[model samples]
Target: MNKKPNVAIVGATGMVGHAFLKVLEERNFPVKDIRLLASGRSKGKKIKFCGNDFKVEELVKGSFKDIDIALFSAGAAISKEFAPLAVKAGAVVVDNSSAFRMDPGVPLVVPEVNPKAIQRHKGIIANPNCSTIQMVVVLKPLHDAARIKRIVVSSYQSASGWGKEAVDQLWAETEQIIKSRIQHPGSSIKVDGVKKVLPAQIAFNVIPQIDVFLPNRYTKEEMKMVNETRKIMEDDSIKITATCVRVGVFISHAEAVNIETEKKLTPEEATEILRHSAGVEVIDDISKEKYPLPIDAAGKDASFVGRIRADESVENGLNLWIVSDNLRKGAALNAVQIAELLIK
Candidate 1:
């Protein structure tokens, strides 16, 4: 590997793709060259990186040639087709889609949790789902201290998790609601004629579903948290369940995670453990009104944890509040961290 790798970003025009460039530049990743690839629709679009303008190129069979690392944020279909091509072209792929995550051959990675898994990559590494990434980073250290027996997590995800259109939909819905209030003053405000990217109206509302529901009644997003958490933690015996909700916030994702551990850990003990853990920030001073908030976590890399307390109903149960920028630590930054591991 060169001291400065030649990198290519798939889906370079999407939200997470743009984040890839931002995180890479912020970290000063050593990149000898960068190729931005997207679908035909985004071709020739200009994106600025490191003070230089780069043209987005249409992704094709030959796009990965001479690329040392390919960071893929395109959807699963695109990754399923092109990731292998990137591998065949001798570029190691760090895919940020669900395409290869469950594949036993691919390491479902969150750098703060299972970084050594990156060593087993068979030409590609899978970044776990955004929600899974943040949760696991906070849980891993505690899991080590007092083996996690079962986990129940409810996520308050942001609009950006669905991509750019969903965010636009949120903004448009809010504007419409505000305008209706100003005009009618007392009538029930109704949002109309906005392109529906989410399953329900997201302004001032929360949707319990994220991805489509499976026969088991869990949405794919929820199941991803359940399945990926076990895989990344390397503990298939652990019981895990999740309810993923799409909230109106535009940036960070927050989770209320309750865990039953094999051994007891008090709130104070848990706080001390997480404080020293990598990629985790402890912000729990409740009396002073300090805790992890999505707005405060936006654009930050750390997984913030607060509200640590014992779940007294059950023995050895603990609860935690976790928050992180869904686009950064949850997606692009995690991918970039994997690439950094590759070079080392």
Candidate 2:
């Protein structure tokens, strides 16, 4: 820890992986060396770091031999198989997958929320789901103040959340729609493209299902919110219900959240609390039609919150809208912050 640590970015060719590199460069994270590892298809690919090019290596047993910290954004199965080997190779792993999150031993973390949980990691630190990360960052300060009892959240997740292929699918589908509109002139028409994402196409519409469905009818993505929230909050009794939807946007992930607290909150008071919280930016101003939008938060690290008000339907209920760059704070940036905490 005396000198800057040598780091490895697992899945370095993926979208989240690319963001990790960007954040590391933007924040000027001290790295004596960097190893960008990906699958065989991406091997030998070059990515720029600090204006210098580095060749991507295929991940293997010895990949982490000299690495001190590993940031894992590969999918869960990859993380499940490779994370331990990296840890055994003497590197601390911060995983951005659902692999080790509920493992009782691994720390489920949002640096802004339960940073104290970092000390509990058994080699792998789990970054909560992207949607969960943004929601909890905004909730922790409020929950600390009012004690959240139950949370109901519906996410408008971007195509990027499903990975690069989904983003490409969205672009391809959108182009087809534009072409169809031009050909049809004033007549209404529907265009369909090769179905590369979701069950169907993802153009000019929203897909309510995200990830795969479970026997209980809720998606695995939805369950991640419930389980991850409880673990990150360190309160098993906290109730959470989530509906994860895939949207056509290609960057930020947005959510509509309603919470039941132990105590009542006024809109003015809630705004005051969030205004003073770290890593939170309030953008509510109906008079000027100003509010948090996906594009506004596409490249930002902070969570943008707006539309704060008390729910009239239930006592002690508060409603909020939250958005953030999923690839940043949701995955890469959060992992980088955890690494910073560890090295400190």
Candidate 3:
């Protein structure tokens, strides 16, 4: 790796792609040069970074030439096609897609959880799902203190997790609902439009499904959390289940995570452990009603944990509320941290 690497960002016009640039600049990553590449439609678009305007070029086989680190967020299909090309071009890819995450050859990494996995990458590293990234960061310290046996998590994900279009849909539907309420009082509020991104109306509603349902009746997003958590923790024996939901918020994801550990840990003990852990912020204070909220966690890199309590149903059960910005720590920051490790 170069002391000052030349980087390329695939999907430069997308939501997580924009986040990649923001986090790279905020952390002052050493970069000799940068190339912004996207789909053909986004070609010639101008994106400002580090006080300079760069034109977005259409991604192709030649895009990875002379690039040291390539951060990919274009999606699984694009990654499956171009990631190998990037690696063949001598640019190590840190992909933010599911294309190679479950591959035995790829290391699915969250810097705060399994940073050592970065060293084992064979020219390509995989970033876990956004939901999985935040949950695992909070789970690692607790799992180390008392080995986790089983996990049950329910995610309240924001529209931003889908993409920029989903966010626009949320606001558009919100405005329509508000106008209907104001004009036709005592009538049902309805949103009128052909829904494009989300499965159902997301305005003032929550959908329990994220990705397509599998034969096992679990959505793909839910299964990703279950599998990715075990892989990152390196403990296949740890039983995991998840219910992913899409909420009306525009940014940040919140999860209600319940875990059963082999050994008991009190709320105070767990709080102390997480407070000292890297990439975790303890925000629990029930008396004054202070806890992790999606609004408060937006644009932040740390995984916020709160609502610490003991589940009385099980012998060694603990509950937590975890929150983080889906685009930052969940996707861009995690990939950037892996690149940082590569440079180190």
Cα lDDT listed for each candidate: 0.94, 0.90, 0.94
Model 1 misplaced stretches (Cα beyond 4 Å):
182-194
Better of 1 and 2 by TM-score: 1
Name the weakest run of 10 consecutive residues (lDDT summed) in model 1.
181-190
TM per candidate: 0.97, 0.96, 0.97
The residue-by-residue lDDT of candidate 1 on 193-253, one tens digit each, is: 6678889878888899998999999999999999999999999999998999999999999
Per-residue lDDT tens digits of candidate 2, residues 202-294?
666678899899999999999999999998988898999999998889999999999999988788888999999988999999899899999
Worst 10 residues of 3 by lDDT: 182-191
Off by over 4 Å in 3: 182-195
For candidate 3, what is the lDDT? 0.94
Off by over 4 Å in 2: 182-195
- Tens digits of per-residue lDDT, candidate 3, 92-136, equal 999999999999989999989888988888999999999999999
